[model samples]
Target: MNNPAAPPSLLPANRRIVLSGEDALRILREIEFLLMSLNNIGRHYYPDGDDDGADAERRAQYCAETTRFIDAQQATTRLALMRRILSAQFDTTLGDDEMDDIERAVAALPLWRVPGQ
Candidate 1:
């Protein structure tokens, strides 16, 4: 696993990598696909049909932990990309109140991935 506090982008910020709108959208799509793939893989490994004994219980716990680890990695990558995008000033006219509301709404979200994605 990479450092939790450090991003894994190959391009350092000093390289002046400005994210276009399309780049940001593509990054979002990649995050969505990663989450779906993780969920599907976990189910494939620990399906309900396999849950009956102590070994099954241990596998279930391991699967849950793996899901959390993947989620955190995806979040770190996406958030780092987001920092680059927002730092470049994609849009600059919103009032402070609007920004605050947006922050609050995003903070309230339970999961970053869209449903059924």
Candidate 2:
């Protein structure tokens, strides 16, 4: 016997939980807000270093902390609800590149902070 063909959304719909566009946008916005806050704080507390090495280290530290924060928050239903709120908040659709930018920003934050201190 031959297997029946599934609908287009069947694969994704079956495998993963569905999140509304508004939900995803809220999460993205929360991430953006957090990063912005960190940038503002870093600008004030973290000095503008003269050398590239010092700058790189500080950014790395920030990124590491941000990554940890995201991982910690991922387990909560509140994050999901907040993302749903953000979905209505944003006017534009978020692409993979945009999501990637968030990751890069997180990774680069350590450039300004001290490492393993």
Candidate 3:
């Protein structure tokens, strides 16, 4: 499996690759979809159906695997965003002071709380 800690290498070479607020919103949406898929798959594989012992065990393992993949995806996305944001400022069309201001703003923001706990 690919390491989620590693930044994606296929990112555009341009240092100032610009992203909009829309892009940030998209990232959240993508994460939600992946998480939902993982949960749905787990529930399907381990439905409270037949009482076969072997099937039960297989489903349990599958659920764990699905959860791991979801976690890894979230980790990878965060790392990727950090790299992108740092690089974005350097390459921005915005002036140096403007870019610095943005960096400060982002830094000042509190960590996001997942909805509904």
Candidate 4:
């Protein structure tokens, strides 16, 4: 089966896909869910309560790293959702200028290192 997430250019030109208001709303809801899930993961990484013997510096670092990671992921997801919405609504792929803006935004995001990586 063809991948639903495939970019418009990857799909057959003869095939036209249109997203209704309901479809777009669903995508927005999915983004909200994704944000919540990422937030939960961040909380898991640094939960409230006792330090569990972890040093304050290490805990602060973890908090910073996790927040950066989640922010990056959220930004990327929002960009992808914007592209998808534009593609479905306009029946066109993003132009180079628009894509360049997205690339710049993503590149400006602070880098995050995974724990132990």
Candidate 5:
């Protein structure tokens, strides 16, 4: 007896959000790294080095010209959200050594002060 060929199958359409504590920690760490990099970029562009009136004005204009991607309000809001999520969802002891190092970096960030510390 001849067997018929199987029909082609369609791809699955359903998606799931499988976020765990570790995933949350990694996300928070990435946000910390992003903020740190942005701060460094800002300092590089807007230096307090000695400059005359015209030079300072030129540098100011240059800084504005160069820094088009930075969104201060968005960064602030994201950082706040990251902090809140990390505190609420994840425990500090649940991470590995790499996360430990990232946690230290996150702690040292000067923008957000730890409460009751």
Candidate 6:
């Protein structure tokens, strides 16, 4: 599995990528779908019942996975909103100060790891 702390090689610091509104919507939809799927899978594997200690480990694992997914979903949603606001209010290419602000905003978002990663 890739390290979650590592920056993506595809996006270098000096590179700037533009995402259209449609792209942002698609990303949001995909994240929602994945979250739904994660919930479904967790339910199938760990149905709610009396906590009999037998399933304690599995339940904890499921809970952790759910937390990660929810965190990622929230951060992604915030990012999409920020992108939309920036696009609507200013040029696609941001100046250094604007970029710094964006970087800070992104850094404030929760960092999440994928399940089984």
Best by TM-score: 1
- As a whole number from 0 to 100, the lDDT of residue 53 in candidate 4 is 69
Ten-residue stretch with the least lDDT total in model 3: 2-11
Tens digits of per-residue lDDT for model 5, 24-105 = 7877676777777666655565566433433676677656744553464365566677666545543344234435322544
Model 3 alpha-carbon drift over 4 Å, by segment: 1-20, 48-56, 60-79, 82-117
TM-score of each: 0.39, 0.31, 0.33, 0.34, 0.33, 0.36
Pairs in clash, predicted candidate 6? none
Q: Write the per-residue lDDT of candidate 2 for residues 1-117, one digit (tens) a residue.
A: 534343222222233455677666767777676677556545543667332545676768766766665566553455566655634333343334554322333443424457766
How many residue-pair clashes does candidate 5 contain?
A: 0
**Ten consecutive residues with minimal summed lDDT in candidate 1?**
2-11
Which runs in model 6 stand beyond 4 Å of their true positions? 1-21, 49-99, 108-117
Candidate 4 minimal-lDDT segment of 10 residues: 2-11
Q: Write the per-residue lDDT of candidate 3 for residues 1-117, one digit (tens) a residue.
A: 423232222224443455678876766666677667766765676576443544667867886787687586675676577566545544234443544334544544556689877
Judge candidate 2 at residue 91 and give its lDDT.
Answer: 34
With a 3 Å backbone cut-off (N, CA, C), the pairs that clash in candidate 3 are 16-91
lDDT of 4 by residue, 48-75 (tens): 6345866888678768876786686676
User: Per-residue CA lDDT of candidate 6, range 1-117, in tens?
Assistant: 533353222224334556678876766766668667776857755677434653677877777777786686675675566566544543334444545434534554566779778
lDDT of each: 0.57, 0.51, 0.57, 0.60, 0.53, 0.58
Give the C-alpha miss distance for residue 50 in model 3, angstroms.
13
Q: List residue ranges in candidate 4 displaced over 4 A.
A: 1-19, 49-82, 91-117
Number of backbone collisions per candidate: 0, 20, 1, 0, 0, 0
Query: Candidate 1 lDDT, tens digit per residue, 8-48?
Result: 22223333446677877877776676677667666666677
Looking at model 4, residue 65 earns an lDDT score of 71
